[model samples]
Target: MPISLSRKFQQWVSAKLDLPEDVIMDIPRITMIGHLHLYIENHSGLLSFSPEEIRVLLKHNHGQMIIKGKDFVIKTILPEELLLEGTIEMVKFIKE
Candidate 1:
């Protein structure tokens, strides 16, 4: 399939202006601080959350982000962002 005109335009603008593609493309941006904090922006959904695991869905069919850890807690959650606190052991991305 060919890229849509609007998406092409967005890419062009992002490159020309040095803008973040994540903001323009609705892709997820993940941030981790040490082994205790996880921040995610532009997440599409929260599939599952548990004390030992977390599963987040990404937008535009980007698939899922799996977080394996212990003593997990949700520090923050918004329409497009999530903040987690835990003893993060592993982080993995599974593309759909």
Candidate 2:
């Protein structure tokens, strides 16, 4: 994918100002607590959810995130954030 001038500017500004790229670039922020709790910020949408698998759409060119676990349960869900609880086994990011 080709990046726009605005994206380039944001990247430059973030680097020059020593700011976090994830905030400026619309990247997803993922936080994992042990193997049980998962928090995702800046997500675009939820693709699918189940006890064993969860898929999320990311913003910009960040692609999609696939989480595989057991006995998964959602704690909080919002327009741009999600919280999941379960025995997380694997996490994968796929660009398509």
Candidate 3:
């Protein structure tokens, strides 16, 4: 198996300092509240947003995170995080 240099570095640093690998790697952290609210952390950018779906660009090769549902709305958008509110039916990741 091949290991990414960035991932190896993150793993080393995470072990050295006892830090969470996700934080060290700048990985996306998602929080969902009963399919009603979604919080995405460490997002690179917003790809698209609408009442039926929302797509966000994730950091690294995690690809685009797509939220599918109805009456989708973005409550807040920050440089590294976002809050989405709606009836979320599904969440999928598509690689670019």
> TM-score of every model?
0.86, 0.92, 0.85
Worst 10 contiguous positions by lDDT, candidate 1:
1-10
36-92: candidate 3 lDDT, tens digit per residue: 999999999999988999999998878999999999889999998999999999999
Q: Which of 1 and 2 is ahead in TM-score?
A: 2
Model 1 lDDT at residue 64? 96
**Candidate achieving the largest TM-score:** 2
**lDDT measured at residue 84 in model 2 versus the true structure, 0 to 100:** 95
Candidate 1: residue 43 Cα off by (Å): 0.8
Candidate 2 TM-score, C-alpha based: 0.92
lDDT of 2 by residue, 75-96 (tens): 9999999999999999999998
lDDT of 1 by residue, 5-90 (tens): 87899999999999999978987898899999999998988999999999999988889999999999999999899999989999
Off by over 4 Å in 3: 1-3, 15-18
Worst 10 residues of 3 by lDDT: 1-10
Query: lDDT per prediction?
Result: 0.93, 0.93, 0.91
How many residue pairs clash in all the candidates, one count each? 0, 0, 0
lDDT of 1: 0.93
